[model samples]
Target: MTWFREGEELDDEDIVSKVDYTTSKLLIRKASLSDVGTYTCKFESEDGHKVEAEFVLYIYKGPSFHDTTIYHEFLEGADGVVLCMVTGQPAVDVQWLKDKEPIPSTHRSQLTIRSVVRADYGEYVCTAKNKIAESSATFMLHVFEPPEVFISGDQHSVNVGERVAVSCNVTGYPQPDLHWLNKQNGQELDMAGRIHVLDGLLEIKDVIPADGGLYSCMAVSTSGNASRDVSIHTQPGPPHYLTVTPGPTSVLFTLKTFPINGGTPIKSFVLQWRKNAIEKWEETIVAASDVLAITDLRPYTKYTVRMAALNNVGRGQFSIENTVRTEGKREPDSPAISTDQAKVEGNSFSVPLEQSDNGGSPLLHLNVKYKEEAEKSEWHKMQLPSDAKSVNLKDLTFGSDYHLEVEAVNSNGSSIPATFNFTVPEQPVSSRMTKGTVAGIVMLIFLVVFLAVDATCCYRNRCGLLMAVAGKLSRWKDPGLKKVEEGEGTTNGDVTLKAISKPRRSIQQSGVQTISKEAGHLTEVTCDKAPLTKNEKLHPTTDA
Candidate 1:
């Protein structure tokens, strides 16, 4: 017996042949696609008679996919379609399924996703069905999400010549590529310069006012890209805050500002803070200074703080809000008052103070009470500023002792009272003068008055009180000299004197010229222009 396949004689050693009395058989093993063809069996006898039989064979294959790729990827929110390209000897029916559930509108071996979402990602099964067999293939579907990015902080404040770091938080299916950009120039940040970026963190060294601006943090990936903006604020115009400290009952904020606006320096800052969700704002004002404390706040509360800069112009726009929470309630500690250092000047007294321990709260002010040491005197109350170094009491009575008490007050309550006694001094005066000194001053006044009278009399009458005294002294010395009596014949002061009417007569014997009239005790003398009375006869006559 002989076997032939596809019109060709079979030559494989694996073919088995058998012969019997009335039948001849040929067997073929391991039949495959290549073995599908016409087969012929030949019978030959020793008497030279030959016969051949041909049989047609057909091998029908099941359905199979064309491509070997079993994984698919698509961006989220994008339209995508996955087709199962199948082949087989006979045309087959195709269907699609996912998670063991049939997919709708997938009769054409194609799975369509409109606006792909994360829920569309998973294993997708494509099955081809035929009369003889059914085959299936699983392809993994992955949906890529765009990088969702956020900055650590929306705004970061820093002084000139400072360092700052900003971080970006990103999440995506595929890790995204991060880049930091400066919005000032709209350029990629220079990693070789003062700024650098590493692992989504941007670090800037020695930042300047020019470096302060909006920075873009971007994340790029195969799917898509996303970005967030960060603000780096410096000084001038508006102020960027530096520090915020919250206590039990107060909030303290310190803002960093340069001393310049548009050629004008900033004069002040308007700070505003309030509860997180409240609309009405609470304002606290004190003597205009650098104290930026907002006191008398509820404890354990969340607050939002902001501020605006004030210059020659009105207040600028308010700054970004900052969320803060005050600490829990805690009573303030007692303060120390330096009563020993108290000072008194005339009608007023001032008591000094030392910095106090405010515990968990802030010192609101100081209270002082005092009263005259005298019995049944009421106490007088006075208040001082929180930042005052001393408390002063004016219009106080001098030369009096008083009971004084000083207590430090805070939001919680007052501290232990410091009690002491103080004596107010009177107006200052020097030591009293001696009795002898007083008597001497009186005698000196009398002498001055008498001298003034004598000088006045002498000017009009050529006579004075000293002259009268001299006359009286002379009379007393001799007790024989006649003393001028008051109102005698004619007082010089009372009478008018006449002019000289007589010429002098000279006595040539002594070269002397005497007045024509003389008093009883003396005579007034005069001089003549004649030389020694012309050296002539000695005569005493009244002639012109």
Candidate 2:
């Protein structure tokens, strides 16, 4: 090596050159500016010096790729996006692939897919590469969609004897294939037995109640499989009714004919009548011929009837029962009686007897009677006041008991007597003195008249005897003392003022008691009369 000095050179020691070669060591070190120099020297040996070339060094960084992200969950038929950003001193290229195939270029087909679906489900790999570095990441895709189905008629309710149609409808993309299966079993059902398919619809014609059940429609596709379930419901049949010809006796009914559910043609019927009110049943079997007559049926009764239909699917739901009732009967009754006041006075009563017909004849006879004391009285014969069937009795005593008896007489016979009794109250009276004084006066006048007549008769008879004696003495005596003429002093009874004959006395006053066999027993009747005043005429005892 040669040295080139830039600073001041020293003396002989600094400029000294090596004249001896060492055989034991070699010196090698990192180059520095201190080692840089240019120097010239003469060789001691011939043809041994050689020359070498100079060199320089330079450095730079490269690109890198990391931080991959997919902003959506992997799902079938759904689009997904993946991002893997690259960072480096140099830029890199970016691209996308599905199933290891680059996407095609078209109006709908692009590397960035829209509305991705099940076919796109797979491992999605993303890669980045540059002059310096390269990287890759992967994501899984899942595809799925549930199934949908429907029925043709969509009917859930149906009556017996009514025809029905059932069908299943299914729809899906990718051309889904459909089939039918029973809910009770996983086995597939045959297309036979009233079951058929049109297009994609599975149909069951004339579906009966037995045909009602849970059915499943299964749809299969390249992507997945789906199924739907449906329920079939039915209603009870129409009503069965029973009617009675003759009604019941007491609001209880007995049907004449058997109950009939009109849904089916009747062969024979069982007549069952139940009291829905009481839950009691009376049952009988009747044929079509005997349906007209129902013996011993009671009127006005309530009943319920039921009918059932039988077939291979077993007896269907019973028909709705009907309730009926019987009619009512008539009753027998009797007549009634009432009365009105005929005549009434103070403390006295006069009643007109009127007889009204009540389930009987008109010519009814009534017996009239009076009694001071009821125990001693007998019926009296008094003519009725009128010719009419009704009668009135007058002059009844006050404060006296009266009884009346009416006998209902018909052409056939007389009925028991109907009796009525009543009493009339007496009128109150005052003045006790006049009743006795009048009796005394009546007695005194009778006594005084009788004595005067007796005195006159005695004087006439004595005078006659004196005159006879004078006559006889005068005839005997010489000196005859002749009687004075008696005619001169005699009083003429006929010429005198007409003397009133003593009035005939009442039998009550005469002290005579008489009785008649035919006479009704005398009843002591007390009449309350007005007090006898001076001008009032006394009641005559006997007509003279």
Which prediction has the highest TM-score against the true structure? 1
Clashing pairs in 1: none
lDDT of 2 by residue, 1-544 (tens): 3322333322334423222233311122443334444433222335676653332221222434456454334444566555555554345444456688654441111135567665665666555555767555565655444345666554344444455445666655555778877664455666666755556555556655545556677888765687776655443222235333333332122333333232233344344566665767665544544333333445566656554433222334544566666444322111111235535466445554544442112233333444454676666655332124443555666678777654544332444554556676665554333868778988889877765665454344322333345445644552211221223433222222221133334222322211111122221111113344553346643333
Q: How much lDDT does candidate 2 score?
A: 0.45
lDDT of 1 by residue, 131-158 (tens): 8789988889999988899888988877
User: How many angstroms is residue 536 displaced in model 1 relative to the true structure, after the best TM-score fit?
Assistant: 99
The parts of candidate 2 lying over 4 Å away from their true place are 1-74, 77-91, 97-142, 156-179, 182-188, 195-200, 220-226, 231-305, 308-544
- Looking at model 2, residue 516 earns an lDDT score of 16
The candidate that wins on lDDT is 1
User: Per model, how many backbone clashes are there?
Assistant: 0, 18
